[model samples]
Target chain A: MKVNEVPQDGNNFKGSDKVKKLVYAVDKDGKYTGVNTKGWEAESFATQQAWAAVEEDLKETEQQVKEGVLSPIAYFMQKCLMDLPLLAKHVGKWQWQVKRHMKPLVFNGLPAKTLQKYADAFEVSVEELKSFGK
Target chain B: MNSTNYQHCQHAHCESGVTSNLLKYAGMDISEPLAFGIGAGIFFGHLPFVKVSGTPGTTFRTWPGTIFKQVTKTLGVKVHTQSFKSVDKAMQALDDVLATGKPVGMLSSVYYLPYLPDAFRFHFNSHNLIAYGKQNGEYLISDPVMEEVSTIKPEDLIKARFAKGFPEPKGFMYYVNEVPPTVDFEYAIKKGIKKTCFMILSPPIPWFGNNAIFLLAKKVKDYPKKLTPRKAALYLGNIIRMQEEIGTGGAGFRFLYAAFLQEAADILQKQELREFAEELTQIGDNWRNFAYSAARLMKDRKSDLVSFDELSDMLYNIGTEEKQFFERLKQVKW
Candidate 1:
């Protein structure tokens, strides 16, 4: 059975790129889509390790952001925001449009579930979720 | 006369006073922080918007940094950051920024969570403060909650405003120095036009948050050429201003601001200085009464207030006044 993630649809510009990366990052033979329990169990440790590394690296940046030393929006756009396109095969127009809209507002509108996760993790509103948006 | 020498307002609760006493000397109804912030915003060539929230949200950045950026961009002011980790260092930064003759504003995020009406529960952002320079080292701040001006050292304000916890930093704030990029109103006008014309116009129903106003102004600029730049800019400012005041639970006051702007525009067109003067006098006198009544309503509904009705009414009025203003402008037999 597939584990439930947060409420997210591939509604952003970089979803395809993100999915591809996720597939590459997780799958050994580049086979994604349907996974068996055995496959899930096999990759669980690897995924956890990868996630830990990413999270650890991000913590330093998060500290800088909180200290007003850097803009997390800028950091996310430069790093993870672009990578989100690897997640899905098709990119929608509205996602790109929203991304463009957010550019002026200091966001690039990547369909990363991280901000929502951050919100959930912090027990704050989704809109109030500070993101390193990977 | 230096930035280090800046002072705060003399009003009660006048914490961050860096504005000139010129208004006070002129017998103006000067409220510290509020007047200072508005004046400083103007002096720095930006419009001020006030936001008061009961809590600070995780997603929301510091109010001063966010607003300083938005207002400066909207008004076509170029701002640069100066580093000052201490009060003395901040004072020197202020002096240096001002010495160059560029207008300056400061952003500070005070962490004081004063009890607010429960209705403001949705807002979890720090009370935002923006102060702009007047003459010499004197600056004014548009403080939303204080509703008054108080003069203090620029360093004190930066500390009081940005320092996170008690026993606040003895250092400086994140200072914002601004000036019209080209010092030419025509350039500013074109910039304003571009901003208004190229952005998405969010429906006025939600009432613009501070940054949203900048985007809305840009969206309006993208309207058809039949709406002249001057008209578009004026309408955009008035629209945002009215919407914002109403959003903050000042329905009656918002109406007056809207109506007075209508009358001001009319008078400007007619070149009827005498009538314009009289209307200005009347507005000045009655605006406070409107504000008082609105404040009382807000106080009563402090815990559960949102003015959807007032917002809709203002949108309706905007449509009417916009058409009238455009028609008058077109038919002016100059």
Candidate 2:
């Protein structure tokens, strides 16, 4: 999702159900509380909008990063994590999550620990990963 | 036109109907030399004929006569020129004439430094705008160096140029049957063509974007007969060499230099001269980097497809903006 459109608070899910999928958290009102795209479908209204917004942001961010507005590592971090609010819960666990989850997505045919190691780069915890589904 | 004679003579503005906006903001180091060359090129290349009429001290009508002469010769059209004894008279005279749909062209010596009133320097630049024809009774002129083709009241044109410095016009103009083509420079650069020749040759001379286009169009006169990488490399190399002789700088120089090297590198890359291409690539990258930085400062990056809002922000953060245009397109890491 676009950085501006993203919810600043941890919970405020006023967006549609499609948006709800992109958000792992929600208030009692069914608004998009936060970004946590654990199961974002391309076809859903919220997911489509979120994807569109994210794509646009990514394009801009990529240009900014390419021009050195952000460092390479920071760009990669924001690219992989910022849109997924679920990743924010793991804050300190970022390295751990990168070791466990992102490595597999980034590299092909890697060993099991590679994912864990990538997660370890961000220090993400297994509990945070489990919470992503909730 | 001897370089030294024309160089010292303040006739740089006199020679070319078009002035290099690039000259006014040139920096200390290389920009000065480049500006001189560009000025030389603009003046000598554009203005070829000068006529000091009305018996020198009596009612001298010193204007860019050949520009009109050539137009009239080619198209058989007449242009208007008026000389006023005073700034007010000049302004009134131009206003009355343009009120009938004729805009006046001015020479820097007569209208600006010698005659124009102190309160009217701004209007001097407006008078420099080459008069095209009238649209809806408003005098139309092609102001390629600043604003594109626009129609302004004769009074406003006189007022702006006069405010800028010159109050009276040095040249006379009338409606020519043929309107000059708005030449495209970017397309020529993209297609790997030498542009300086076209700038020197084209009538009323192409300025900036339009000048750039005509040069390219002339280069590729035969459609579907594309400039091959090898040929383009040679052509570009020649351009850089000419630019060196002309003392051109800024985006114009850097772009030519970068394009030359890039074309050479592409040729080598195609020919499996990887190491050579890599070296050329380094040279090209440096030139491109510097050109882009200079262009950003000049607010001349419209060719990069960047939006105005982006340009404003980019101008604020120039260093950061440089890479945004040149960043290697990364493979979409899905």
Give the number of the best model, judged by lDDT.
1
How do the residues B1-334 of candidate 1 rate in per-residue lDDT, one tens digit apiece?
3334333332211121222222222223323322222222110011223211111111111123333443345444444655455566676665555565433444443322222222121212233433435443445553433334334444445434444322223333343333443433223223322332222132243232223323333443343343543333233323322322112211212222222223333423544322332332233223223223323323343323423233233333433433333233323332
* Total clashing pairs for each candidate: 60, 69
List residue ranges in candidate 1 displaced over 4 A: A1-134, B1-79, B82-104, B110-159, B163-183, B190-194, B197-334
Model 1 chain A, TM-score vs. native: 0.31
**What tens digits encode model 1's per-residue C-alpha lDDT throughout A1-134?**
11221112232221111221111011232111211111121122222223343455567656655665654542343233122221111122233443442342343344556445433323345554454432
What TM-score do all the candidates reach, one by one? Answer: 0.30, 0.23
Off by over 4 Å in 2: A1-134, B1-83, B88-127, B130-142, B145-156, B163-250, B253-290, B293-334
What class would a CAPRI assessor give candidate 1's docking?
A: incorrect
Please compute DockQ, using alpha carbons, for every candidate against the native two-chain complex: 0.01, 0.01
iRMSD values, candidates in order: 27.7, 29.4
